[model samples]
Target: MKEKAEKNKLLIGIILVLCIVILGGVIYFMKQKDQNPDSAFKPDLDSNAAAMEQGDGEDEPDGIRIPGYPSITIDADTTDVKMNLMNPEGNPCYFTFEIILSDTNETIYTSKMVEPGKAITNVTLKHGLEAGEYPAVIRITTASLEDGSAMNGANVETTLVVQQQ
Candidate 1:
């Protein structure tokens, strides 16, 4: 009877230790998952209209095309800015335009994905700026048409002229 009681206690102790180790492992994995939530999430390339607009031909350039931006002017009191954000034809990727203020590194405007041979004519700024000439950058981010993965991009430095109307 005494030997049987000792064996039962030993079995219970082993089981409890295994349960604790498994619980610790679960907690560790949960924390790791929280650290990198979007590691596995990939944006669908097909959903972007730009990806579908890619033209197939041997004439298309093998390399990415980076577009340039001229200095932009806008009214001080209004957030509406007239600009043309374009993705050149024969390019193989999509373009995303981001207009950032140079002094504060603040992004005033971000355009939707512009497909090849398409353009966004107007954009609403995040906020109106004071009447002054501000140095700015037009940061272009290119994404692959095949997989929506990020590709080589460009930053075109320009001036943002905010004038009182």
Candidate 2:
């Protein structure tokens, strides 16, 4: 009886230690990821912005994320821009990304607290277009978290042709 009790106590001690180690590891990783959010960004999907079409320019991030380089299509007259996005995780209670038309530094889209497992799509752009060629500078900004605790951010840029409408 005494031996069995000692063995059970030892097993419990080992289990407790293991749990602590696992919890600590999780905390450490979370902190590291938070400190370097850009590192976690995945540029797997392609961006469907207007600039992508018509062989336009792209934003070059110093250390950020951008989906594979893909072009977008443009038509004459009125221009329509589309922006598609995927939420990174399911727990992003409130995450935000900013889309800017660089030419005028105008914010075309601002998504807030996008739900995870859901895809954000079909954001249209609005601006007067001329017959001449123009650089539709674009900028996309995303952060690591939503609780103001996030510091690292990622940005992407691209340009599009504005045909005279």
Candidate 3:
């Protein structure tokens, strides 16, 4: 009985050592990733989108499409809009957004240097728009996470049906 207990104690000790070693390795890797933001290789967004286009000759997304940005919203003379941005991958990304009025091909809003994982709640639009259906487009450009090169761009077309409150 004594010998059996001793063997069990040794086994437990070995397991504890292994656990500690694993924990240390995990911490070390996380630190390394933080220190070297460009260590991971992210596929070029343009290449990926181009490949998809060539595959079936169909339009596909390049950067990760953010949710909650409805294709359409009624401005109703609202002053500001809440735009959101996010970086789905582990790398940081720079974004450029523009709002264009399709009727006149006028760029109503233009914003550059948006960061990752953020919501732009202070976006404002010109009020007193004539009550009617207006077609607008939002163009988004994603730059390289490492070097801020032009990676990919896409457009989100939406219609605003302005009505008096």
Candidate 1 local lDDT, 1-165, one digit each (tens): 999999999999999999999999999988898776475534432222332244565476678877676788888978877776778787778788889999999998887677777776667889988899999999989887756788899999999888999
- Candidate 2 vs candidate 3, lDDT winner: 3
Model 2 C-alpha RMSD vs. true structure (Å) is 12.3
Per-residue CA lDDT of candidate 3, range 1-165, in tens? 999999999999999999999999999999999778587545333211111111344454664554434554445667565444333333346556677888898887666555554434456665446667888887887776666677666787777667666
The TM-score measured for candidate 1 stands at: 0.63
In model 3, what are the clashing residue pairs, if there are any? none
Backbone clash count, each prediction separately: 0, 7, 0
Lowest-sum lDDT 10-residue window in model 3: 45-54
Per-model TM against the reference: 0.63, 0.39, 0.51
User: For model 2, how does the per-residue alpha-carbon lDDT over 1-165 read when each residue is reduced to its tens digit?
Assistant: 999999999999999999999999999999998889686544333243212121134443343334421333344455354445544333332235565655677775565534333445664545434544433333334444344344334454554444433
List RMSD in Å for every model shown: 6.8, 12.3, 13.9
How many collisions between residues are there in candidate 1? 0
The candidate that achieves the highest TM-score relative to the unseen native structure: 1
What is the lDDT of every predicted structure here?
0.79, 0.49, 0.61
